[model samples]
Target: MINHGKELFSAIVPTEQKGLKRKIYVITKAFIKL
Candidate 1:
């Protein structure tokens, strides 16, 4: 159970990071347009 939880957590973390990076990229582009 602990191992399964760890795997699930690791998978979620990368997805969250990707979302965060995308958000930052969009914000940066908006700033550049200004």
Candidate 2:
């Protein structure tokens, strides 16, 4: 059970990171446009 939980946590982390990266990219693009 502990290993399964760890796997799930690890899986979630990358998705969150990707979302964060996308947000940063959008912000940067907006700034460039301005």
Candidate 3:
């Protein structure tokens, strides 16, 4: 159960990181347009 939780956490972190990066990129682009 612990191992499975660790695996799920590891998988989730990267996807969240990628999403955060994409959001930052979009915000930066919007700032550049202004």
Candidate 4:
């Protein structure tokens, strides 16, 4: 359903985006520190 897909996108996409951002941040920080 179109509504279902939109709901799924709203719920899931931002969370995954934020998680990946945090991971990249940590990795880059560790790299810089070392």
lDDT tens per residue, model 2, 1-34: 6775565556556657678776556556545655
Q: Which digits, one per residue and each the tens of the lDDT, describe model 4 over residues 1-34?
A: 6775565556555556678776556556545655
Per-model TM-score, in order, reads 0.47, 0.46, 0.47, 0.45
Ranking by TM-score: 3, 1, 2, 4
- Tens digit of per-residue lDDT, candidate 1, span 1-34: 6775565556556667679776556556545655
**Candidate 4 segments exceeding 4 Å error:** 1-18
Candidate 3 Cα errors over 4 Å, as ranges:
20-34
Count clashes in each candidate, considering only residues at least 3 apart in sequence or on different chains: 0, 0, 0, 0
Which 10 consecutive residues of model 4 have the lowest summed lDDT? Answer: 25-34
| Number of residue pairs clashing in candidate 3, backbone atoms closer than 3 angstroms, sequence gap of 3 or more or interchain | 0
Q: What C-alpha lDDT do the candidate models reach, one value each?
A: 0.60, 0.60, 0.60, 0.59
Query: Residue by residue across 1-34, what tens digits does model 3's lDDT show?
Result: 6775565556556667578776566556545655
lDDT of 3: 0.60
